[model samples]
Target: MADIQALRGVRFNRRVAGPVGPLLAPPYDVAAEFTDGGEFGIRNIEASDLGAGSGNHALAARRYQAWLKNDVIRADPKPAIYIHRHRFLLQGVPVERTGIIARVRLADWSERVVLPHERTTTGPREERLHRLRAVEANLSPLYLLFRDPTGEIRDLMAAVDANPELDDHDQMGGAHRLTAASHVTIHDRLASLVAERTLFVADGHHRYEAALIHRDECRNTRTADRDSPSEFVLALLAAVEDPGVIVRPTHRLVTGGAANTPDAIMRMLRRWFDLRPADVTTLAVDTDLVGRVVLPRRLGTWDIFAQRGRPHLELLPLDRGPAWLSLGVTAIEGAVNRVFSADSEEVAQHLFPVVEEANAVRDVEAGRAAAAFLLPAPTLDRLLAVAEEGDLLPPKSTWFDPKAPAGLVISDLRL
Candidate 1:
């Protein structure tokens, strides 16, 4: 069973911190790419101190202490479950996603209470663990999904009538509103609703693993108690049936491979997939198809009329099981492996995942990449089924849009 509890969340003091917009940042994995005027706009918690050096961890810890000392950020007076409503635009369509931010007891994989679908690498897991040890806090919330067919949880969330404590937009123009629900009755009911259902990790697999390791380490050191803060991780829980919970497809780019020439790659792909010519201008491949390949144009950019003759390959598998072919990312991985005669490790080195189709196309047209493999987004039901069956998907298979920004609510594990 899953144990969820309200947390005494740590938040920024807008009066002292100036504004919440510049202090917020994306998760740590992509925070390196974000810059505000050559540096983070302010000495924010998660984005400012992610340097590649070993001393970066200590720097983050020092900055966190300084913020607390200067009243830039402070902890709540009482424990409460935070109601977060994240509103953003997806493909020009407005979306509002709501979830509860709470502390969840960490469970080992063998327990099977909380399940993860995507595979994680060791490098990221270790890096997160090191940062956790130095900071002793959860700077970001893990995105989790649960089954709520009865809509009971949604109704409960809607009942929260307290005024929002933080209502503002981030640098990406996403609107975030946070309210604290401190009613003991509501917390008990919310806990009961999720107690019977299994929790699925929609994102933050590496950070989850790091939290588990940190808990075990604390136990070994005899510093943890029965209700130690280290035993739980901060997470944002949402229902799988929520319409705002959207998953986008991640396209793959091939930078360096043995099949460097377009002809060589085409011949190899033809052996396993039936390819059809597609319009280069609007190469929106059918979702029912297995995959699509965009090779580098020989002469001009994709916008030019002369480039319209470029061959855009639409791939359909010749023979494959429905169970295996249903996963678009898995199918693409298999085709890439077979085409290049490479194993999973070799493919990881040359093949990179990109969330935008335009970026993938540009990389190929600009001669930076050999080819781009565009895939269809996987359904939520399919992903959940794989997790329930104890199966794992490829890395970066699902991109959950409008991610919950870091520093909205921090979980301090000092106790």
Candidate 2:
């Protein structure tokens, strides 16, 4: 059974802090990109003591204590599950993703209570572990997907959404709301709903692994307390059937050498896969390519994009060289790996992954990256299937939309 429960969350004092939309930031990894000229940036906490040669994790712990002392943040009076809602636009279409934030008992992968879709790198995992050791707090919530065909959780969240405690709009004009559900009756219903369900880590795989590491370390050093809060990690549980949940493509930008010239790269791409020039006259005007020719997993059809002087190439996927790579994104990665010596350190340096298609093309035009190989976004079903089969995907294959903002509901490890 999946053990999910509420906990006392530390939050910013709204009276002293004013609006929290500016205060609530995305996770540390993606927080840097969204930093504005604000005094309450979490980057301030994560990077303040880095230059003095002090370890970041220790500094993070100190910062947390300092913030608590200064009334920058305070813990809730009672334990409760937080209802989080994000309303934003995707390709001009409005989307709202609602989830319940709570602490889940950490379980081993062998136990299969919490699962992962992508293979995580050791460097990130270790870094997260170090931070966990020093701070002993969950600064951000990991996004998890659970099977909920009957919308049991959704209906419950809807009732709470009617009257949220905090409702504010972020700088990007995205709506964010937070509400508490402290009643045991509702809590028990939710716990029972997920008692037999498995959670798939949608993002923050490294942090989840670090939680396990910390749990194990605590076990070896001291007597194991099965009921201790240290055995849990913060997570935002969203249903797999949420229509707003969609996977976006992160296109790869290859710069320098042959990639600098479309002709040079075209010569290499043609050797293994059939390339046909395609005309894309609808990129700028069409905000959402709902009716465009850009379709993924459609056999023998993938678009290769370049600047004005370069020839546009499309893949003839009729022959994928016996690889059962059904998705266009997977096929592109396969061809790029086979045709280009991506294994070499020299080639890897020039490669950059970007989420925006317009930005990818702009980088190539402005001479930042030599060329960009554009690929369509894969369906959520396709991504889950790959994970279920025990197969791994290439780096930057998927990017979930409107990253769940951090700093809203913090899980205090000391609790």
Candidate 3:
């Protein structure tokens, strides 16, 4: 069963911090531009105070403690589950997503209570573990998805939205509002609603692994109690059925390999795929067909291909599982592997994932990459089904838009 609890959240003090917008930041992994501010806008938690660099962990710890001591941030007196509403525009359309922010007990992968659909690398896991030990806090909440068909969870959130504790906008012009539900009865009800459902890790695979490692380390040192803060990780839980739960495709950019040449790629893919000519203008207007097109740099043309037939599945690489075969990324990986005699890791090294089609094209046109493989976005149902079947997808498969930002609510382990 899933174990969720309310947390005494720590947030920035408006009087001392001046404005919440400047202090807020994107997730650590995607905050490269924010982290390069030197010492000017360096106050953003994701940049210098969080896990941005290897040698900055100790410095981040000192700055965090100083902030708390000087009233730059304050912790709530009562424990509560926070409700966060993130509002943003997608292709000029307004979209809003709501989730519950709470502390969830960490469980091993074998336990099957908490499930992850994407694979993680060791470098990121080790980096996050060091940051956790130094900061002694969950600087950001992990994004999680759950099933809520009865609309009971949505009803509960509506009541909490009547009043908001913190309202602000991010650097991207997205609106954010946070509210706390401190009543013990409300917390118990929220926990009960999700007790039977398995929690899926929509984001934060690395941080989740780091939390497990931190918990074990504390136990070995005899410094952890049954209810130690290390036992739980901060997370934002949302229903998979929510309309605002959008997933975007991540296109691949190929560079410096046998598969980089247009003629070579076409010849290899023709063995299993039927190729057709496609115009770049048609692809630009219709995203549905974008996944099927491949653009080679300096070729000034694009080709769309479809699998010839449901060929023998046994002959293909079935190690990942049958569910993975339905994804566009899986097909691209299979083609690259068969053509170049490479494995998944080797293929990953030569291909880069990009969220926007324009960006992918720009890289190829600018000579930064040799070719681009545009992919289709996966639906929420397809992603959830993949997770439930105990299968894994390639890294950076789905890009969740309007990512939940850090510094909104900090989970201080010392509390």
- Clash pairs of candidate 2? 255-370, 300-317
- For residues 337-402, write the lDDT of model 1, one tens digit per residue: 766677777767777899998999889888898888777777888888878777777788889876
Candidate 3 RMSD to the real structure: 2.8
lDDT of 3: 0.77
* Candidate 1 positional error at 139, Å: 0.2
Candidate 2 Cα deviation (angstroms), residue 165 = 1.2
| Candidate number achieving the greatest TM-score relative to the actual structure | 3
In candidate 3 the C-alpha lDDT for residue 350 amounts to 82
Per-residue error for 258 in candidate 3, Å, reads: 4.6
Worst lDDT window (10 residues) for model 2? 287-296
Check candidate 1 and list the clashing pairs.
none
Model 1 error, position 52 (Å): 6.1
**Per-residue alpha-carbon lDDT of model 3 for 1-415, expressed as tens digits?**
9999999998888888766765666667776456433332223444533444556778777878888998888899999999999888988899889999999999998899999888887878887788789889998889899998988998998887788978887666788888999999999989998888899988888899999999999899867887899899999998888877878888888777755576666666566565566655434333223255455544545554454454423325666555666776777767766666787888788878888888888887777876688877776777877787888787888888766677788899889
User: Rank by TM-score, descending?
Assistant: 3, 1, 2
Q: Please report, in order, the local distance difference test score of every candidate based on alpha carbons.
A: 0.78, 0.69, 0.77
TM-score of the candidate numbered 3? 0.92
> Which should have the higher lDDT, number 1 or number 3?
1
Question: Highest lDDT, which number?
Answer: 1
Q: How close is candidate 1 to the true structure, as a TM-score?
A: 0.89
